[model samples]
Target: MRAALALLLLVAAGTAGAQMYKWKDAKGLTHYSDTPPPASARQAEVKNFNSAPGADLPALLAEVARSHPVVLYTAADCAACAEGRALLQARGIPYSEKTVSTADDHAVLKKAGSPGQLPLLLVGQNKQIGFETATWDGLLSSAGYPASSALPPGYRHPPVGSAAPRRPSAAERERQAQEAARAAAEEAARGKRPPPPANAPPDFQF
Candidate 1:
């Protein structure tokens, strides 16, 4: 038993001495070899594991987001928009969605360089007008996002547009107050009860 154990330890020591070389060619493809790579190859720092190109994908992707934020422009009742959203969510991409519901929203979309297309995805200044899984995947891969779902379970993204309460701007608040007053006056002219304030909380009687 002692002799067999000694032989196993010798084999293990030999295996540990085996050298592996890693390098990248001019075209930026990673190569791994047991033999030394060519002098022209860009030798990568030796690591225990075979490191692929973009081995530090998560950190690189985070840096990309800081420099080139992702934005998804969507609209309600749009199937394609839902699919595009699902794709981003499945890839664990952090993005902000701008809903094209109001005229102002449409204007914002246009200024983002979309040609009135639905499901427009913005990667930094780069814009994708329509949702195509292959194309979107390729772009996301190039941006260094992981190619698979990495989201934690029950990870709720910010509620879809209109589902979350939004703070109104000062100008919007004033405009809403004016509209409310106009509505109340119109209701009074009809001899009906005036409506509650626009921002009033619901009063439920059970």
Candidate 2:
């Protein structure tokens, strides 16, 4: 038992030292490999297996996630969306959720080629329009996720966010307002003529 335990420790140490590279190609598809990314790769990142919290994820699961990241598009008060989310949770699939509850979110959904469908699932470049258990399972399987839960204990999916770009923060809004005010002040200082009065005749000049 002592010998076996030591051997396991040695293996774990070796695995922890392994390096992984993650990057996006020109087409914006993400890739992961043990080798350095090619010259064309963008947003390249290097990770040591055990360098950070939750970085000790199982080898196969980590590789699969990097190669085929999963995204779920959902809307509030939708039964199908709830079911879909439940399925992913039950399977312990790490994924990002995008809530589609606004016009901007709907536009993003349309851009993704959905005809306003709820509970859209995207596994890498492939997409599924609705929540069908078998279909979703099949897509996940094809993307290399395990048949059963393999998630590490205490692992949690990222917090859900809007499908559209997030609204500017208060500070950002303030900065923008100040810039606009400054521009207006500069224009006024330049004596730029104001528009003619709305009540004036069409032939009236400023």
Candidate 3:
């Protein structure tokens, strides 16, 4: 029940449009607490909502294109459509927007193999529809976006060198993690610092 409640709280914090709360426990483990966390623990867990979910992709790509070239196809007045534009602007991305407000616009989108999902982003040789966060992030990342938030700010992104691509192979990541862990453990043992938490029990640290 506690875990379920925590999950729901996390979801509501994002979906019901509430602020996010964060905290770090005694063992350097982070947690999201609805209430304020300790002040001196490096960082307390309390922050406002980043933004609404499901952004308009075309607009987002355009904003990213401020640093690159981006193309978009969109119609007017769709809620998702609005989000698409807002996202691009928020990220400071500049793009070429082709409004499909007329039959010719509709024909252009169809001829270009784009769906009628309003914000259709074309980054390089790729085309994506809807507000797929991972896909947008990947496309923008590939097209040289300078580390903008694809989603609202609270949504996490991967580290600089490590990208969380859409449908990344889990096994490959696991194997790499294992290899890194083994290397770290070996280094620690050679330096007489125990095993360096290689086989530390889950949830045992925090």
Candidate 4:
């Protein structure tokens, strides 16, 4: 009888230890949280605890950058994506932001896993889909990435149109024309012109 009582007592203690928590949010809305909320908050019932992604921000970015090509797969007009772009630009880090919105972007989305989520940050040969602040910060840091908000010196976006300037200044044009004329005159003086047709036969030798 004593052994059975001890066993029952152990089961009761275990159940008590696994109690659910409840709390209220600032909105006066009562909520449940696994971890301690602010002063006004209380613990919530965590149906099942999950191992959250925890990473060292800086180290994560360094490692992630090396193995993964930073691809910010974001949709157009996405505030997070825009902020993300600004963040990357500040760091002066090079990245290909595939803005998806139109049909073309949709095609890219299909390949990347459409019907998913936006602001999809990829790195370290692995693509992390979703909006997890901790995970992203860790990945960026691991990749040795500069602070996302740091600006690169002398950064300028190339203007649209021809990459090389097509219009030359008047001075430049005249200079080139003069050079060409001088070169032609030198060729003529060198007597490098072809001979008359009468002396142009293949059988004729110089």
Q: Pick the candidate with the highest lDDT.
A: 2
Per-candidate TM-scores read: 0.49, 0.60, 0.38, 0.39
Q: How many clashing residue pairs are found in candidate 4?
A: 25
- For residues 83-133, what per-residue lDDT tens digits would candidate 4 score against the true structure? 666665666544445556566555555555545467766553446676665
* Candidate with the greatest TM-score versus the true structure: 2
Span of ten consecutive residues with least summed lDDT in model 4: 157-166
Error of 1 at 151 (Å): 3.8
Query: In terms of TM-score, which candidate is stronger, 2 or 3?
Result: 2
**Residue lDDT tens for model 2, 8-112:** 454455435444467999999998654345557887765545334663558898777766667788999999999999999999887777889889999988876
Model 1 scores a C-alpha lDDT of: 0.62
**Residue 158 of model 2: what lDDT?**
58
RMSD of 2: 20.5
Give the residue spans of candidate 3 off by over 4 A.
Answer: 1-68, 149-206
lDDT tens digits by residue: candidate 1, 1-206: 33345444543443232223467999999986433345467744332221233322245544665444566889889999999999998888756566887776777677667768898887754678889999998888777677875544543343344212245689976875676666656655666556677777798222
Better of 2 and 4 by lDDT: 2
Instruction: Count the clashes in each prediction.
Output: 0, 0, 9, 25
* Residue 144 alpha-carbon offset, candidate 4, angstroms: 2.5
- Rank by TM-score, highest first: 2, 1, 4, 3
Clashing residue pairs for model 3: 22-45, 56-83, 56-84, 62-93, 62-94, 63-93, 63-94, 64-93, 66-94
